[model samples]
Target: MPRNNDLNIILGDLKSLFSIAAVLMSAMVVSSLLFWELRSAAGFIAGMLVSLIIAAAIHSITPRSEALELKHAIIIAALAYLLIPAVSAIPYMISTGMSPVDAYFESISGWTSSGFTMLPAPDSIGHSMQLWRSVTQWIGAVGVILLMVTVLIRPGTSAYILYQSEARKERIRPSIRSTVRTIWKVYLALTIISFFILLLAGMPAWDALNVSMTAIGGGFTLYSDSIGHYDSLPIEIVLLPVMIAGAIPFAVLFMMFKLKLHTMIYDIQVRTFAGLIATGCLLLVAQNYFYFYNDLFSATRYSVFQLVSAITSTGLQTTDISGWSPTALLIMSIAMIIGGCAGSTSGGIKVAREIFLVNQIKLWLKKTLLSKKAVIVIRLGQHKVVEKTITEELNEATLISFLWILNILVSIMLLANILGPEVSLSNLIFEVCSAQGNCGLTTGIINPAISPLAKLIFIADMWMGRLEIVPVILLLRTVFRGFGR
Candidate 1:
């Protein structure tokens, strides 16, 4: 690619993101109006105008391009993830009176769909601000690039690359525009349906909308107690499927909705994901029953909900996570780290990767134990996975897991040094996993009182987790080299 072209691609991609931000700002403006927040509405309108101007200026300067290479897509996607949240932080600072760093932290957390918050009293956040938070997660759920593809980009190779770069690997339609449109259709339909269900379950309309967005995005809630704030079994039941839907691939959901239920049911990844959740829940129930709560009903209720929440990376806590026994917390932490299926809104290592890694190990052991000349095959579902394919998948999975652990360890050190010895190591590990997995469950460690440096680490974790380590690292390397070809 020509140097100028690369610059143009980056600028153009960023322009699209800012354009989306402008639209989100308009929604926030309306939200502000609904809440009678005059200053907040004015601030959002001003932000929207500035974003539009920047977007237009970039579009005017950048040369027209029909295609973007994978590198271009990665760079653009990475930069957009970083920059979009900075723009999103404006409302937090404006409405919540949080410090600039804290506000940016909140925005990054929301944008990454990682439910960590610096707010001392989440319920005290302005209504518009709370809605904006949910909206950001909703946008981040599918991604900004998907929105751009639907509204801004023409159907082309560039659009597809950008779509894939946003961690969306499947297409439900032939054309990029059609695919994005269909995806938005499914997403919107689910959001509306889930909102109504929550409403029928007795939640206020406003809360319903917020939870619908948050649940679909696999994001934690604005309420400090999360889903437990409702204290209604019906509401929890209403949200369960919505969160699960977020964890399932949109493509699979699209197929299932089209009456191809076998496509999702027989999927190896889906089966493994479902099995993992079920097993985790059972183990947690036993652990809680034996160690924490003597009552089976109480143990099962809390255990099942939190286990599902953690596994799906939804972060809607139904129990006090801090009070969980060490064994139970460890199980939940592992579930969070394993995460949901690939190409879904849920984050973490993803069950697909974990399954691949396990299969690779099995293949290696079989080959070793049988004979040096033994031919080995790894199968995922009914399809035979070739050695080269399995190797690549294993490499990708292991490298990502290593990086995830390294980042968490670094963050843990930072937290311990800043928060002192009183901070529980297990809780810190749990919190770090939550951030890195985009699993919003926390042990009450996240708040405004934390050190500024620690907050920056958490911000980086959320960003890194959402981008899955590769794109962000590549983007950083590209920056370090001054974008040299």
Candidate 2:
């Protein structure tokens, strides 16, 4: 009876998860029919039907619950995130005829908003699949749980717990429901604005729509060559701000809608993000100008856009960087690992946590060397953060950062064993960082034709990176020791 109770508890919220999931999958089915120019809607219709059957089957059995414990929240969060990508993979398998691993890799990439493409030949994929990838990025950026809050969960401890499990905590409103819906509004507005901007820049409607959705979430592009295929300065210029916008915290984005700028100017995350991008841009400009491009205009052109895309974790690129200098690649690697602001669509260690860790390091130094008399109180913004508060928050932030580095090292080791000494160590490291950081920039080592084992490693990195590591940790523990959790 106790075991049954636990099972019931676990299955509780998943009913709503699958129910809403079916609804979201239907949008792709509609999109498929809308784009009847290719394989028509058969693949999409089949994908949606399978997804609906699964949702219905799950909904029929899942026991309802009033609330979720922390463990349950983590489990539910991990399960939904993992499952949606798997179910979404059905479409790719049916339509593109990609191998299961490759198709799942493609689904995971889009759902994690990592933008890595595993499609054997992207050009041959139908328009529906193309749009599905963009939609996955858009929905993934908003989050499955956050979407759940829109129509499923009500106000309570369970609501907030489920929301936090999505790797977000910044409350833009008094209520979780209001906050998520507002974020949805902000995200929608940003995408719409980006779409029109790209359209004005002379991109075709479909291209503009895909870029708007993918760029806002820092996801993959439609073409194999990425942004470079267009070769239009206007398109690149239009996308630069959109990519950076993906990195700005949703709270700041909401403030921007209210036309608030002075307060935003004082935000440490904003300042830090700007500093990193500017520093990276100048460094890349110098390297490119002297080593490759030679022309200042051309160097700056490639430098600024690529650097912003890297820092934002947006995979769009205007050049085939397979030949870029190691120095340039390394510079972008740092940007990718540092990542964007907390609570933004972009992924990485996050700017807010980085600031906390930096301050924590200083606090430790002051106590050890400068003495307690130094009185260096840790602060995030205008507010004075208590020492205990700093310690509490810093603990998780540091743990996640450590695991992030460990994952990078492990992923690199695995890739090294597979690729051997033929590949440049710099390129290998750069590719690993890009995958784990959810920054889709390719240093040429990762591609559709890469070994299947290598693809799985990247898929793991994307999953871990998207969950920011801890939820994945909790998930593994639950899987290995159910009762222990």
Candidate 3:
């Protein structure tokens, strides 16, 4: 009876998810229609129909039992990541003429905010498709679950579970629903302001809007060369703060609404992130100036923008990553692994995790010097962290970091086996790390020509990275348990 009830709740949650997806698809259909892409519009509308039908069927069959729990939320969140992309791929398959695998890969990339593209010439894909890509990333940036929480789900345990399951660790309000709504509003305001700034920076209106969406999500590009297409310092300067904002905790930004500038400045995660970026920028500038480019000005120009992009996990490249020196690549790779803050659109192990790991390491060494009889408590940020809390966090961070490194090795091996001797080891690592970190920077390896197996591996990496691995792990355990039973 318990198993049956859990199944019913899962189905009901999925029905709600699909219902929201239908609305999203309807908007896409309208956008396509506005662009006179009748076939593409029809494809999107068809997907909406399919979503609605499935949602309706689930609603009609499933009993109206609110047997919701954290497990149900975890399952629903995992399934949403899996299934939403499947439905989203329909337009790509029908209108873009991509294979099912490639279409699914593109959808997953956009939905995960990973920004890896299978399409070689994104500009050729038409305006609606471009807008669709941006829209997908924008929705994904905040997460589909968070969207449901703000606009659909009521303020309750279910909303809270869904929020945490999506790896959202920050709340700006007491109520989960109110918190999500506030964040969404902040997200919208930032995106709009960025759009106009880009426009004033001389970008076309459509491109501005699209880039604003992608940049705010820390997601993909419309052009093949990414932000490099503009080649305007003013444009990159305008985008810099937007990308930084996307990488920051929404709660910090919310505090700014109340004019808590001191909190924003003194926040540990923000301070650490800013310091890392500054130090990395200096290192890369010197390295590039001495070894890669003779002109210090030219080196600083490229180094600062790329470092900001990488550290933010925005992945909007202005310079060619393939040509960067090994030292520069290493610096950028470390930044990608550390990523942005705890509750940001950017992905990685995250700055918060790294902060915990570093502080814990310091505490360990201090204990080695202290007497056994002494009592010591470590402080993180402004709060006193107990030994047990530090130990648990250290364990969690170590496990997640291990998984990240393990997957990087696995991906490198897979790419070597599949793509052969032509692909350099460093380039493969860069590509793999970019995928797993949900950073879109690439070494010119990602494209349609890659094997379906490689694309699938990247898709899995993006999914795991975005959820920070726990929900996905729990989901797998749930599946295995069901099978065992």
lDDT of 1 by residue, 1-485 (tens): 33776778788778878988998899889889988988788768877888888899998899867557888888887788788888788777777677989988988888888887788777787788777888888887777777777787465877788788877777778887888888888898889999999999999888888888889755657687888888899998888888888899888889988999999878888899889988998999999999999999999888888888888888888778798788888898898888899978898889888998899889888887988776778888989977889998799889988888888788888878888898888888888899889878888888888888888888888888888888988887777664565
Estimate the Cα RMSD of every predicted model relative to the unseen true structure. 2.1, 2.0, 1.8
Highest lDDT, which number? 3
Give the local distance difference test score of model 1. Answer: 0.84
Per-residue lDDT of model 3, residues 249-350, tens digit only? 999988886788988777999999999889999999998998888898789988898888888888899888788777788888888888998888888899
In order, the Cα lDDT scores of the candidates are 0.84, 0.82, 0.85
Best to worst by lDDT, what's the order?
3, 1, 2
Candidate 2: misplaced stretches above 4 Å? 1-3, 37-40, 120-123, 369-375, 483-485
Candidates 2 and 3, the one with greater TM-score: 3
Residue 326 in candidate 2, Cα distance off native in Å: 1.7
Predicted model with the maximum TM-score? 3
Per-prediction tally of clashes: 0, 0, 0
